[model samples]
Target: MRTQIHSHLQDNQCLELFILEGDASRIRELSHLLNRNIKTVYSKLVSLPHE
Candidate 1:
């Protein structure tokens, strides 16, 4: 599943997924949506080392 999802992440790469309400269902639904749209899903990691 991860491989398939990552494959489609090239066109629409999103960089955040905040499940503050702790809803797994939402994530799953989002995953499905992303796949349906062939969009990339991104982890909520909001910082990079200064170059």
Candidate 2:
């Protein structure tokens, strides 16, 4: 799932904002929309490069 999202983000730059912000609410919203677990989303977020 992390790989999938990362690939998607790499393909579309806009998605990077969500990861860059590191906002829990936005993460939760994305998780819900993607039907992915919040923990999984959170884990992916932490793995993102820091600005």
Candidate 3:
């Protein structure tokens, strides 16, 4: 897991990035949860080719 946080003191805002790996279904479920949260400004899912 890797993450990064950015804060804007002037606007009192924060941005976050979370990189996750696992089953596609599980990831989609988590994405839905985040999107439902008002705090989530944006969310994206990226899949890499695997054997």
- What is candidate 2's lDDT per residue for 1-51, written digit by digit as tens? 233332344443323233335566776676566546432443333445456
Better of 2 and 3 by TM-score: 3
Please give, for residues 1-51, the per-residue lDDT of candidate 3 as tens digits: 555566664466666666766687887898799889997777777777766
Q: Where's the lowest-lDDT run of ten residues in candidate 1?
A: 1-10
**Residues 1-51 of candidate 1: C-alpha lDDT, one tens digit per residue:** 222221223455434444233345665676567666634433232233334
RMSD of each: 11.6, 9.4, 2.6
In candidate 3 the C-alpha lDDT for residue 49 amounts to: 73
* Runs of candidate 3 exceeding 4 Å displacement: 2-10
User: What lDDT score is found at residue 37 in candidate 2?
Assistant: 42
Instruction: State how far residue 31 of model 1 sits from its true place (Å).
Output: 0.3
Ranking by TM-score: 3, 1, 2
Q: In candidate 2, residue 47 scores what lDDT?
A: 40
* Pairs that collide, model 2: none
Model-by-model lDDT, in order? 0.42, 0.45, 0.73
Q: Which stretches of candidate 2 lie over 4 Å from their true place?
A: 1-21, 36-51
